[model samples]
Structures are given as C-alpha cells and as structure tokens.
Target chain A: MPSPALRVLTDFKRWATPLPVWSGRLHAADWPLTARHIRTQGGRLLAFWGEDRRAEESAYLVHAAFLIATGIVRTEMVVDPATAVYPSLTSIFPNALRMERALYDLLGIRATGTHDTRPWLRHAAWPADRFPLRTDFPGTDLDVAADRGYAFPPTNSPDLHEIPVGPIHAGIIEPGHFRFQVLGEEILRLEERFGYAHKGVERLFRGLDGAAGARLAGRISGDSTVAYAWSYAQAVEQVAAARVPERAQWLRALCLERERLANHLGDLGAIGNDAGLAFALTQFQALKEEFLRENQRYFGHRYLMDRILPGGVAFDLAATDIAALHGAGRALETAIGHLQEILAEHGGLRDRVVQVGVVSPERAAYLGLMGVAGRASGQAWDLRVQFPPSPYDRLQVRMAVAMDGDVAARMAVRFQEISESLRLQEEILRKLPDGHPYHPLDLREAAGEGIGWVEGWRGEVFFWLRMAQGNIRHCRPQDPSWTLWPVLEEAVLRDIVADFPLINKSFNLSYSGHDL
Target chain B: MYRILREVLRLGKVGEKPPRTQRDPASASPSCFRHSLGIRHVDAGSCNGCELELNALNGPHYNLEQAGFRFTASPRHADVLTVSGPVTRHMAAALQDCHTAMPAPRRVIAIGDCACDGGVFQGSYAVVGKVAAVLPVDLQISGCPPDPDALLRGLLRISGEQVNS
Candidate 1:
C-alpha cells in the first residue's frame, strides 16, 4: 500500500502550469477528511476561495490548493444552495481561520465547524446579510450599515489591559487596526482587524478582458505588481493555450528580479530605522530610489506595472538596455558590500535585533509561515527552487536559509537575497535571448480554469482564474501574507509593546494584500 | 563613527533644485505658517502606491523637509491633510473624524488618481467614489500614483509663493 500523498496524486488528474499541478473535483463529504489526510502527510494549504456558480449550476464551489511534496494539487467541492454550509479545515490547518471567515463574509457560505465566526473582510460597511461576491448581489449598491461592533475576546486577567492601535497609523503607511493585551510593557496577546483597504478588486475582475484584468492584478499590491501581473498573464496564457516567446520569458524574469531587489533594499533600510539606526534609513532609501529610477529608464515603469500582459511582456530590451542593466548591477553590488560591512560592525543594531521577535522552526512550520520570512526560520520552500519555472529553473538559483528565526535572521535573508538578485540580473543580461517579446492573446473561445504560481518578493503568490469564453467568472489572487499575518501575532507575544514596530517591519507582511 | 561620517560626507547633498512654477492663490499656504508646513497624511483606502511616493518626499533626493514641508504624526498639529485612495466605506468615518480634528485653516490635498475621482476603483460597492465626495478637496494631484516630484511640487505650492529645495 502507498502513502496517502501518493494515493491522492492518483486520485486527481494532472493539470498544466509552470508548476506540477493536479486538480480534481471531490464530493462534499470528503472535504474535511481529504484536508486532514493532506495535513497528516505534512502538506501545506496554499490558498482557499469560494466561487458563485449559481448561474450555471445552482451550487457554490469551494476550492483548496495545497503544496504537497510533488507540486501543487487543487481540490474543489460543491455546496448545496439549501444549506450553503461546508465543513471547516480550521482544526486541521489553523491558518484557514481567516480565509474561512473571509469566505463567509464575501460569499454567504458558512463554515460549520470553526469556532471564530466573526467577520474578517466585512467591517459593517454593508448590511449584515448582504453578500458582495454573490452573482445576485448588485455590484453598485452603495447603502451602508450602522456600526454593530466586532468581538475581540477579552483577557480574563485583572492585571492585563488592552491597547487599541489605529486603522489610522501614525506614519505614512496603510491602515489596519491592532489590539494588544499587555501587562505593563510585555504583550500577552495581539489581535488584528483589517479590511480598511479592500477595494472590491476581485469583483471588478468579473467582466474585464485579459488586458484590463492584468492591469487590475498589478494594482492588487503595488509593491508586488510585476509578480501579480506575471502570474495573471501566466494563468491567462494557460487557459488560452498560448506559448510565450523565449525572450518574453527572460524579460519577465529580469523584471521579477529587479522588483525583488527594489523591495528588499527598501525593507532593509526600514528594518534598520526600526532598530534605531536613522542613518541606515537615509542611505538605503537613496539606493532604492536610484534602483527605481533605473527601472523607469529601462522598463518604462518604476514599479513595472502593465509591462506584462496576457500572452507575453509588452516590450523587449535592446542591446544597450542589457549593457545598462549589467552596469547598474555592478554598482549596486559594490555599494551594498560597503553597507553590509557597516551594518555588521554596528553593535547597537545587533543588540536591538539579534534575539528579538523570534519564531522557532517548530512554531513556523506548525503555523505554515512562508516566503522570505519562512526561509529565515528554516522553512526552505522557495517556489523558484522547489518548482522552478523557465528562467529560474535554468539560473540554478540558490536558496537562503537561517535557523534562528529572529529579526536578525530575517535581515540576513533580505541582504542575501539582494546579492543573489544582483547576480541573477547579471547572468540574465549576459545571456539575453533573441526573439519577439510578446504574442497577442485571443481568449474569446477559451472556456476553462487555470492557476498562476510565482515566487513573488514576499513569498509565493498564487493566482487562480476561472473563465468562460474569455470573460472571467472568478479570480482569486492569494498573497503569502494571509499565513504570515497570523504568524506576526505569534511573533509579538512575550515581547515589549515598543518593539512591535521593529518586529512587524522585520516580517513586513502586507496590509493591503491581506485585506484585499 | 568615523566611517559613517566619511560615507555621509562622500554622499553629500543629493537633493535636487526645486522647479520654478506660478503659485495659485486658491491652494497657497496661509501667511502665518508659510515658512514651514506640517502636513498630516490619511490613507483612506489606497493601494499604497501613493504612500510610496509620499515616503519618497522625505527621502534625500526630493527632501521636502529642506523645502519647508514635513509630515506630522497628529492631525491637530497639521496645516494640511494629504489623502490617498478612493475613500472606502470602512474608512470614511475615520477620515471625516480626522478632518474634523484639524484646527481652522486646514487644507486637504487628494494625492492620487483614485483619490482625485475614484480612478480604477470607481463605483465599487465598497468604495465611496472619491476623496472629494467625502472631504472638501482643496488640491488634487493626479497619477496612478503621482511621482515624488509631483507630490513635492504640489506640497511646495501649498507651502508658500517661494518653493525652494
């Protein structure tokens, strides 16, 4: 007899993507049992979303994509319209708590077994019973409900008190509320309330064509625009059965690396600022600005938004562009080397970050923490390495891993990733492929679903697309921040309230991405 | 400390010279606080693209502080309020309360295309159209995200007649 992992692989038929994927429809009764079986086999739940399929069939379909040993396996099950309830996977995968809550808030589906049923993305903005993502819900109704309040569980201790931070933070940052229960300076528990940044992006993708949908995907999170656009393009290409040109693949890789370098440079500086090194902030910000300016010079957009489209990239690089890229990489490498030495020798910086905000390897694995944060805590699961597609597969990419799982570990990972990105950029420029950059896509007759998996700067970004005759039916773009945000609440425990900013910056999970 | 000082001096004065522009009387800074403007920023429901440009205003290149503009942590201490994003239903109340908290002579500057007139996110059920729909927008700087240079120029115009770097 084979293990459950192998057994499940046989159960689902293979699906095509850059990553090895197998997808199948399952009976509703087997949803929880299959989730438990995969959890027992040490598989990680990647993303979970619900779709309103009432127009075609009078049932709602819920989908779960899991990261097993081989690759990604997506499973879907149908829920009857009468009950509109499905068994919860929260007991098996604790990270599913928010996704389940959000599923309920967006669609009117109920997760029968979860304890916490309070709203995740709905903040009394609409009526209590009104579901936004349903096919029947009018997309333009502007009526709002009065505040009915959320239930943040109270601490029983007389000694501990709560500190409610803002949906409007002090700095020039996105809005999300954080509630910390503290005894003096030390934190006992932390609960987060988001949805202040939800723009109804998924609903906006309903009738948009491939080009408009790709543009909306890029804006899903501005920082990871390239990743989201590339991912969205890949999903469309898969569904349309179009093969992107060789040069287009290389250019996409180049844009992805540049995006990674820019974000990491900005984050390293912010982490230093949080550690009380103000000089580091100015220096790093200058480096990142220079990098972004170059992005505008070469790629046409600083953030590389809309550079990627359905079948391929919008443009190709000239020989002079390639030479310029090589030159920029060398200069950045030299400057970063100098900064790394200074940061290493700074004692105050080391003391502030070395052991703070620690999440043990065991804790990280159990909680399903992923991406650069996961890599820092010894979760060595980079999609670039695990399931390398195209350029990354050929680049022989190196994975950065640190076992300490502290602020220092995360900073080290960011620095290492920056160096690796520069090296990758140099290699890509040296070996530039010759071909057209784009292939125009026509998905008018395409009627199917596909998934786009890309290792975005923060972590693995998963985009699932369901379309009929070129028009999108449902699309869910999942950010790794969904799992990382809960881990942040865990990282804050037993640490002082003042250190929250430092800890949060170390992880640098996205508020807009998670809220959407 | 010596290396840090040396590196700092080596990279001396990366700030740019301010662009010359005619100032509009409608959005001009009040005479009392013209020397420096303490601005408070509210991210009503942005994609953080506008916030990125806003942060760059404080970076060494644009250096709005040297040009007599800075961000304040409190609304009460602000002379101007810069808002980004089309106002979301969840954030509308908080944004209104923030505006009400400001002292008299308070000016509102909408920072992005979305904030200006609900750019791409217009008419969504969760969105409240635009920043002007909720607050009295005194100035609107439009871009998917207005670049740092545009943001700095807009703020400097609000600061006074003389915009300097």
Candidate 2:
C-alpha cells in the first residue's frame, strides 16, 4: 500500500474530492467507515483503531488507499465496555497480534480474535486481571519476589536446544530477551520477549498540555528525540491548525537530515564492526562524535532534544552556525571519501555484507517496509521527496535508493543518503528563508483530529492525535519499526543463526518505538 | 608493520588519550573496583529514547568497551545492575529476578528520567511506575534518557569512581 502521506498527496490531486483541499483538521464524524480518508488524484484511506484514556478516547484511523490499493492491510479494534475486549487485527496482519494482545493486557482491552493471547508484555509479576494501564490500577509494592513466578517455554527435544540470551547482552546495549530454539546450530525458531525494560512512556502524557507533552515525546526515544519532538509538534500544530514559520520548517528539515546522517554513519560503522572490520568502526565513530559535538555546540543537547518546538524551532542557526555546518560538511566529505577508498580496497567486507541478509524485494513489499530498509529493497517511498511539506517543497530532495535487498544494499543506501543529506544541508544553509524562527501559536481546547507525518531517520513516523477539552484525547505515534521488525524476522528465516546480529543491526528496529 | 599502520590509522590522533580530566587514574575512586554490571533493561513502555542512547554507547563513537565495562548475557555473572524504563507491571518480575540473580556488592544505576522517577510515565495506569519502587537504586542519571556520556558517568559513579576529577 502507498504510505499515508502518499495517500494524502494523491487525494489532494483529485478534482472530485469531497473534502476541502486545505483543511488541516478533520472531524472524526466526517471520516469514512475506515475513520479517515484523503482524496487525492489516486485517493487513499486512513483508518484509526482504538484510543487510550491517558491520551484520548478510542479512535482508529487508516489510509483508504493502503487497504484498497494493496488489500493486505487489515485492522480491527474491539472495544468491549464490560470486558473491554477489542477485536484483534492479527488474523489479517499476523504482525499486529503482539501489539494487539499487549494493548489488551495493558489497557484492559482484550482481542477476541487473536490466536495467541499469551501474556506478551505481561508476566505473573502483576496480579492477574488487574491491568496496570487502567485508570485505577494500583502501583506494585516492593514486597514482590524477583523470580517468584515466571516460566519460559521449554524445548526438551534431544536434538533441539534452547539458548536464552539476555535481558542484558555482551555489548554496551539496551537489554532485551531472545530465546532461540535451535536444532544443532540451525535456529528453528526465535522468540523475542521484551518489555523487561518497559517504561510506561505513553501513559506519561496523561495531564500534560501540548508543550509539556512535547517534552515527554522527545524522551520517547533519545536517538530519535528530534524526530519524536518534531512529529509530536507537527501533530499538535496540525490539530490546532497552527502555521509554523517557513524558517522553522526549513530548520526542522535541516536538523532531521543531520540526524539521519549521524545515525547512518554510526550504523554503518557498527555494521562493519560487528563483521570484524575495526577500521570502519574507528573511522565512523570519529566522524559521528565530531558531528554530534557540532550539534551540541549549536543546540543545547547533542541529540537535539527540545530544539524543535510545536510552533517552530527553539534555536535559529546564525550565519556562523551555518558556516560551521558547511565546514563540517566538507570535513565529513573528506572522511567519508577516505573511508570509501578503504572499503573499496577491502573486498572481504563486501562479500560478508553483500548477500548476507537478503530480504527479497517481494517480501519487502509484502511487509510494507518503509525508510532506508525499504529503499534498499527497491521501495523508494520518501516523504521528503514524494510528499514535500512546506520548506521541503521549496527545497528539492532526491531520495537515495538501492534494489539489492541485502546488508550491502542497506549500506549503499546509507552512503548515498549521506551525500544527498550533505547536498540538501548546503542548499538549506544557502537558501535559509529570512524570517523569525517561530510565531506564537494560540491553541484552543476545541475537539479536532490531525495526522502528523514526518520522515524520521528510521522511516516515516506517523502521529495521529486528537484533542478534546484542551487535553490530548488520543495520540498514537506509529514508528516504522512496527512494520520493519517483522521483516527482520522474515529476513532471518533462511540465514544462519550466527548472521542474525548482522541482519538485526541492518534493520535496527526500535523495540521501544514499537512497544509504545 | 601493516598491523601497526592499521592500528595507528584506526586510533587516529583522537586516541591521544581522552584529555587528562577524562583519563586520570585518580579520577577513579580508590574504592572503585571494576565491577561486572548485569543490566536488566525494562521497556516499562518507552519510546526507545534510553535504548537509543544506550545503543550509542556500543557504537564506535562512545566505544563503551574502553571503559572495562561489558554487558553480560546472564544476570548470574553480574555485579552491578542497570535498569531503564519506569518499571511496568509486566517487567517487574523480570527486573527483580535479574537483580536477585546478580552477585553481591551490586549497585543499581537507574538510567533515564523514566527510570529515575517515572519521569514521563509519572501517573500512567499501565506503569508500576518508578524503578526505585521495584528495587533499591544507587544512582539516577536524568534526561528523557541520559546521554551516553551521562550514562557512562553514572556507571563510573556507581562503581565509586571519581568522575569530574
């Protein structure tokens, strides 16, 4: 299915579209049976599913085109007031089962149609039937035993062995649980049970106003702080119909591109390091540190958190900052050039990454993978280039894509993307609009719903927010990881168990992004 | 000779010792012994902020390996415990088991604002909420998730290292 942003753009191009062309906020009632529809030249459908009380009343939005165009995207929400049982979308999209069951467990919402309603995120630690996310759920007392009652599925076969790795891993990394069922060295099945690090981030937005909510949003994922904050701000602005200053929009794009470059560089280095290529790690690490230090010098936080506010950006780039960025760009170019030369000389590195984890184009399409991973697999659906919003439209963007569908392809896409980002950054610095960084937005407590779509480094970040009585009625930030995580599972199917790390790193799907 | 050249190129001039402030042996507390931390990371449901920064530490730039700290696969072999997230009901037991499995002289370093005081998940129904509620915490590094540098500093502090010196 074409992404929601594309669906919106297509709908905008249609003459017979019933909806007003430029309406920023759409009433929930006016939406189609699917909850929302944008009529463009090819028209697309947006559907909303359910809402959490912490954020908003129950609502689900889906892109019309995503359903009709592909006929693969199926979603359902069962809101049973008595048992609070929500219909499951797993039967249609097997991937949604975990999230749906998790929602059921957390929100006291049950998914009746789900096949495995196993305690996904929920274990025996909490009292049975006492849903934690419910409004009245009491906090747990410290008297609880750490291992009082928890059981993992056992594999008792003579040939088949179970390997339990982590809640803590060998590298300096986030903790997660991976239970690998293997026959001889071949992994038969892999079950990932996370939420060992559940932080209840979504519930944090309970009583926060727009500004306070934005701060919370930035913390949702630290590396993607700029993207989350910008996306949250975009959703809030869209709901309030607030117009961001042109300069702010441009700066947001610049920061996002920089974020993309920094992450890509780090990932590129790590991918090589994982494969025993120490040279790439050192080179990329140095480059990444330099990049982040520049960001810290310009913005308060190295990660650029709280820099992109709701109405506009918090900090404006002075001419000197722009000049410094240009200088940094030149340095990056030189470093990347040297690294590329080294990479070219080392053919062994190429062999390992080229076809190591191949997620065929066909599978990529079926899974609806987006972002660089999608681009690597021949799906070049970039929000910046295809659906240029504001400053992006004025400043052209050329997406980088590769059709190899392998680790090398993903790497190539990142390499190309860094060059493209540099070019775009230079253009933005040169043509930065002459104006104030922000304009005060007067947001009212009226009921309205808006979808904010931004191209985060990972992929398209979709935020569907509804405001009621001056509070966030509902806010759902859909990370592209939701779609890509399953793709990683699919990609690992035929590959060796030893190669899992390389494949997993290639995707780097955000577990936190998906859990929330 | 080639190996030396490669090492020199890989280390570059940036390896000239992380300024004296960052490298002083005195900066490490006399009592601060290098301890193997067995970290139990909870999702408690986050946006992945803490994880990303944590991930960054493993990446080349931060190169956490340089600190003599390594992430172990099992809690049984760990000395210090690191917890992320606001402590959700789902992960509460897992967090505790991880803590219980660790050997003595263990300290818990709560990384991120959420882990510190339910930073964002302050009053959510789904949250159990703060890391302190489930376990005793020795240090709190705040931010939505503290920066990797801050996280490293917190780890050093928990290990009884003198950080700023």
Candidate 3:
C-alpha cells in the first residue's frame, strides 16, 4: 500500500537505473545467513541461478536475487571447486529448492543441506558428472538412455493411490509430467515434473551476440515473447550502456500491454472452457485472434518476437498504425466488457470456478507464489507499480489484487488486468513520443553484468546477463511460473482430480519457460 | 444460455473457407481419409509458438472441423499425428510411444521450423533434433511458427484435400 521505503542503503552497490537494484557479494560461509537476513526482513526470493566462471576464477558463482520491501537485492557467492557446494536457502524460500537442484544439475554446483536432492533439469540426457554450463564441456546431444528411475516422494499414506498424467497431455499443450496422489476423487498430493521442453536455452545463449541473444530469449517462452524479448533487450542495453529513445520505450510498453491483453483474453476463455463453458473458449479465442492480428499488422509478429531488439524496437508505428490501434482497442474494450458481464452472470460457471482449488494467503506466501496467481492470494506485488523501469513509471500503472485466492480470484485478476492493459495501451498511443524506434547499440566495447526486470502478462519476467567481449557469457531468464507451479501443487490439495484442469488452466503456468 | 445463443447468432458464419493444399500431388493419400481426418498433436519440445497456431485452427476463424479435420484426444482415434518443436531427448521416447499408439497408415506432419529442423536450438545438448530424427515425418510445414492458415492447409493436404479458401 505504502510506497517502498526510499531504498535499502546497505553495503550493496546500486545499478545505474531508476529501478532500485542493489548488488552485493557474499562470503561462502555467510550464504545461508545473508538469505536468512533477507527472509527475516520479509524479502521474497525472485530468482536463483549458478554461473560457471572457473575460467575467469577458480570458483563457481551462485547468485540469488530477492525482492525486499525496498527493492531488488541480488547477492552473489563464490563456491569452491573442491567442495562445489553452498548452503541451501530452501528453508528460507521453498521455491529455491528446485533452483538449487537445477544449479547442481546444470553446473555441478550443489546446495548442501537441502531436503530434495533429486535432479531437476537433468533427466539423464547427459552424464551426471558432465555439467553442460561449464566452459570445458561442449554442448553436444548424446544418444543415452532416458532417466527412467525418477522416484516420486511418497505422501506416507498407504491408502491413497497414485495417478500420473502427462509429458503428453490429451490437449495440444507443452510437455510436463504430473503425479497425483488421490483417494477416490479427492487429490491428496500433486508433484509436477517438467524439463521435457528444455531445449538448452541458456547454453544456446552462450556465444550469441546481442542480436542473436535477443532472438533466442524471445523463443524462451513463445506466449510471452514480447516480455522475454523486451527484458532481454533491456538487460543488453543496460550492459551496453545504451539509452533507448523515448518513442522506443513507449512502443515497447505498447507491445507488452498488448501481449498482456492477448494472453489474458486467451486464458480467461480457456479457464471458462475448463469450467464447462465452451462458449467462452470460442468467444475469447476470436477476441484473442483479432488482438494478435493487430499485433502482426503493427509489430510484424503475431507474438511480437524479434520486435524488441538490443537497442530498441524493430518496427515503428505509422499514423495509420496508431489510428488502427485506437480502433482495435475500443472494439476490444467493448467485447471484454460484454464477456465479463456474461461470465459474472453465468451461475454454472460461477459454481465451478468459485472457491475451487483455494490457495490461502499463508500457503501462497510460504510457497513464494507470484505473478497473477500471487496477486489473487493477496500478494500485492506488481513490478509495473513497485519498480517501474521506464514507460511503466510514466504510465502510473494500477496494481490488481484479490484476497479470496481461489480460481474465481485468479479469473477476476485476469479480467481486471485486461481492462488495465487496454487503458494503458490507449494512453501509450495517445501520448506516443516522436523519435527513432532504434538506437543502434554497438556492443564492441560492452563488458559488464546487468539485470532486466519486466512485468510480463503472467508475472514478473527477470533476465540476468553478463557480456564479455560483445558475446553472452552467462544469461538467466527466470519466469514467474517457477514459483506458481509449486503453488499449483499446493492449491490442488483436497480438491477433486477432475477439477485439476480448471484450476491448472486458471494458473496457466508455462511448461517450456519453467523447463528452460 | 440465452445471452450466449444471442451472441452466437449475432456473430453468425464467421468461419473462413479451408486453405488450398500446398502438398505435391505425387504425395499419395489413402482414399478413406478423403472425407474426414483425426489428428493428435504431440509437443515433443516446442516453444509453444506452433501450438498457438495449431490451436487457432480450432477457433471460429479457421474452424478446421468444418473441413472434416478434428483433433483427437487419443492416438488410437487419430489418422494424423501433428508434431511440433524440435524433439527433446526427454520427450523423444514419449513421441515414439505416441506414434506407436496411433493406428496403421497414420501420417506424421511436423509443424513449424523447430519441428522440421532444430530451428534456433538446433545443436543444443537437450534437443534431439527435429521430429524426423525421432519419427518418420510425412510433411514439414516451415515457418518460425506456421500461421493458422498454413497449419490448416497442411492438415487438409495430408487428408488429401485440394480445397480453396
């Protein structure tokens, strides 16, 4: 409610951005202690990643970025190659468990004293000893046998039976495995296993220049291409010390808001369809199609991929384009209003959605739930409002919140967000700045680490990039789905197995993004 | 219900005509699939860009069902398996198993550039190359992610349709 305290004036060095970002180095011994200090001060672990810097230094570096009351605080710790282990923050932030496991799986950097030691990203695609992210290792596909010995933790209830779904779902969706422990119809426990869609995005970004890296980042998650691309560009620009033009910033905001609107429309329809309303799917899909068509007309890509390059946007809006957007926005606003009324009035849909798969605020906080799903559970954290970067700061965005923490609440948030995005788009178009869309970034002399934070349609999309001699050294793109997936597991507890589709659709976490 | 019905009536006949087949005539198809075709889509390891286009085929705009093509829930009921994304090593086995589950004389269509080749992630350690690397691909529709119209055209071509939009 209150504006974040001016800034955390600690020992951390602040980045050269209006957004509050403070970076601090931590001793290996104080890894867990520093994490506890942040946790005690009510900080949320935003992202945790490991970088292999053995060539530059003997030790592997583990970085944890946290969102405290003030702003983002990124802390780095060096892990000795001999030990190859650091203190785990799983107890402090439950979501860090998967990240720490992924760190070990990718870079052979283990997080000691963690409850779960199971592999997260490594599904026996490569040897256990061979870490792909290491400088010495080459990125080559091996014809090895798949990991068939994945052990799902027992819920300690012998009476409950297990039902495993996916890796290949009935619907046309991304791949992920879900194991559910159920008694009759009620689900007791649900464990999700992803990485089936992992295409080694981080490895692919290793040697790419700014242009190529931006393209790869866009593909990290197709649905959130605009967000990923923008965030990647922002990070690259920050590292290159390139200032994007005012018009470019506003245009980027337009692409992001449009992306948010399109996704919300699509998800709202799917959620309604999952609740037994087929009409909603058809109507919403049509609306979403129209929205995307406009994007193609103006931005040149249906999903706005490759539109946000390193320095600025790929395409600029013409007079006709601006007029067309205004027309489309009005039509969309009317359609969305009608759909909202229909959804609100539909009793059967309401009965199916309301109070189903409830993730209480306490449970949400404990699991570090974030993004649209988090806001529904009373996590009043929207990056657009809290730490607005450029155009978002100018937009004065409204944060959407709900307390029920149910499927209805998530749906409500989506609808409200759609309205807000439409409003934002109208404002962006009305006060469209006049300048070149691109600034022509020359990364020949660029050599530094920078962080990019964008409030994507789903939630906050964070990118951490380190450039060395104009090429990407280490890049980490963290999707909000990382935290929300576990929250889905918690939300499904005690709910009927049949309602899983509806609840999951409401959350709508990305498989490729999470897996990557 | 009344509101929905009224809304549907108001937006009447919005479906577009089926796009013409881009497939070569030499690629023969079984006569039984001439009238109707059932497809099962397997996302081996895609960015979900192709999946979005494929999903758009079912919307009111494209409405592939009117052209006698439908997405089946089970592989057993499918005559075509539409695969997307470069096949990840993790999903390679599942993809093969899915192909194995389909009935005889089933065609495999790889949608998007990623499914055709590896696209951007061609040489990644996690990837197992394209759909053809894992399964016998009959058709490869190329694009970063083929548009819905292209996706529909690909489906109809495999089903032996030469219809025009």
Residue B10's lDDT in candidate 3:
65
Q: Each model's C-alpha lDDT?
A: 0.86, 0.67, 0.87
lDDT (10s digit) by residue, model 3, range A1-516: 112331232257788875678888878777777777777777789999999888888889999898878788888888999889899999888889899898898999888887789899888788788888888876554643556788898778778889989889989899999999999999988999888887888888987999989888999989999999988888888898888899999999999998899889889989988988999999999888888788888889888888999888899999998998999899889888888988999999999998998999888877777789999999888989988878888889998999999999999999999989989999999999888988899998889998888999999899999999999989999999988888888888989999999999999889899889
Please give the lDDT score at residue A66 for candidate 1: 89
How many clashes show up per model?
0, 50, 0
Choose 1 or 2, whichever is better by DockQ: 1
For model 2, state the Cα shift of residue A129 in Å: 3.7
Per-residue alpha-carbon lDDT of candidate 1 for residues A144-205, written as tens digits (9 for 90 to 100): 44233888997899999999988888889898899999999999899998888888878888
Query: In terms of docking quality, how is candidate 2 classified?
Result: acceptable
* TM-score (chain B only), all candidates: 0.91, 0.78, 0.92
Quality of model 1 by C-alpha lDDT: 0.86
lDDT of 2 by residue, A1-516 (tens): 434653453232221111112222223222332322322222222223345443244432222113233221223232435556544445444446666666655666666655676766555546667765566667564223333334566777878888887655655555567777777677777777765545455555655677787887776666677788887887788667777888998899888988898889988888888778887777787788778788889866677888988889999888898899899898788678767667756677887787878888877765566788999999878877776777788777888888989998888888889988888888989999989988876765645666666788988776666677657755666677766766775676556778778877887777666666
What TM-score does chain A reach in every model? 0.97, 0.85, 0.96
- What is the lDDT, from 0 to 100, of the residue A46 in candidate 2? 26
What order do you get sorting by TM-score, best first? 1, 3, 2
The DockQ-based order of candidates, best leading, equals 3, 1, 2
Q: Give native contacts recovered, as a fraction, per prediction.
A: 0.65, 0.51, 0.75
